[model samples]
Target: MAELRTEEEQVEALKRWWKENGLSLVAGVALAAAGVLGWNTWQGYQENQATAASMRYQQLVNLTAGNDLDEAQLPEARALVDEIVDEHGKTLYADLARLMDARLAVAQGDLAGARERLQSLADAGSDNYVAGLARLRLARLLVAEGDADQALNVLQSGVPEALAAQRAEVRGDAYHALERREEAATAWREALRLAATNEQPLYGVQLKLDNLGLESPDLEGSALETSSRDTTSHDNRGLDA
Candidate 1:
């Protein structure tokens, strides 16, 4: 005859197993739920911060656009930007605030301050589009500071491909300042070739070419002569009277 275990024995074995492993399983589930809630809270906090920063930034923009910004208003704008940068430096709005600060510094003739802000942005490694603009503007400031070598170096080395034409133009200007005429001419030509039709001013490139002793074709005269010939032909056709 086989021996049979009582139902009580099976229930006790299950209780022992639950006692050993059940708490661990419950703890894991609790941790996962906490993690999900924490992530959602963090996301909501970020959204709220971004919204507030955007509103502040818009106010700054309106001040500038309305021409209500003076030296007094500059401080207010600066304070707001500083606040946003300190609180939400990782946000897109922070990058915009930095750019605005740089522009305001330039307008105030605080070139050194502007250069510093732009350099910081260029090195931020967060937003490449803004970084590219920062590098380009920094190069211009360096050029204005008579730091031709440093400006040329920045343009040549730091500029991204999207701003290559502008960089080449600035490089040409730097070369010209350094009296490297041949190099300047080459850079200008490269800039002309790389610049988009809407982005580049033809007259500016023509002026550069003229400075380099390159001849510009007299398109006006050709157009005038064609118009005269067309007028003469039209007049002849009407002369039957």
Candidate 2:
């Protein structure tokens, strides 16, 4: 009977040990799991905040469209854009805002200011699309200022494939302005080739060819006179019949 009591006591002690330490072990593991979940939730919240900042940046863009920089509202728009860029420069919208601001400066006829803004965007690292746009616009401004050589240099340096047709067309215009007719024609031809078939305007290409005294088979006929006569006859028939 004593041996039996000793065995019962040993079993009860084992049960107590398991009840106390096992519960604590399980609780510890659960706490560690919860901590991981909490960390992930915090990271997601931070990402969401950055995304909201970007959306606000886009709203600033809509507000500034076609608005004169000298107006009262312009300062407010600029302030919002600047805030986003300063606070969330890592966001894609920040880079886009800089490009938008530079374009606005250009539209306002602030060539010096535009160039300065564009230069900053161009030098910003890892923004290939914006940098390319800056270079292309800067080249156009240079051409407008009668700096054909510099414009050509900008084109020769590099331009993105998406802007190739526009670059070629502008370069052709610059060359034509410089009295380099052959170069202009060559550039225009390249532009025509690069342009999508459906998107390219045939009349503009024909005009360019004519400016270079180049004969275009497409414009060979007196189609305009015939169309005009047909339209006149149609109008007269309604009156007569």
| Candidate whose TM-score is highest | 1
Q: Which 10-residue window in model 1 sums to the lowest lDDT?
A: 232-241
Provide the clashing-pair count of each candidate structure: 0, 0
* Predicted candidate 2 versus true structure: per-residue lDDT over 1-241, tens digit per residue: 2123222322343354446556764465466657566756655665686678757775775676442444666667767768878887755557666766665565555678877876677677234555665676666667667787877887785566755765777788678768898888887666666554324221254356555786433322243222212211111110000
**Model 2 / residue 223 / CA error / Å:** 23
lDDT of 2 at 33: 54
Listed per candidate, the RMSD to the true structure in angstroms reads 24.7, 25.4
Question: What stretches of model 2 exceed 4 Å from their correct place?
Answer: 1-39, 67-70, 197-213, 216-241
Best by lDDT: 1
| TM-score of decoy 1 | 0.63
How far residue 166's Cα lies from its native spot in candidate 1, in Å, is 1.2
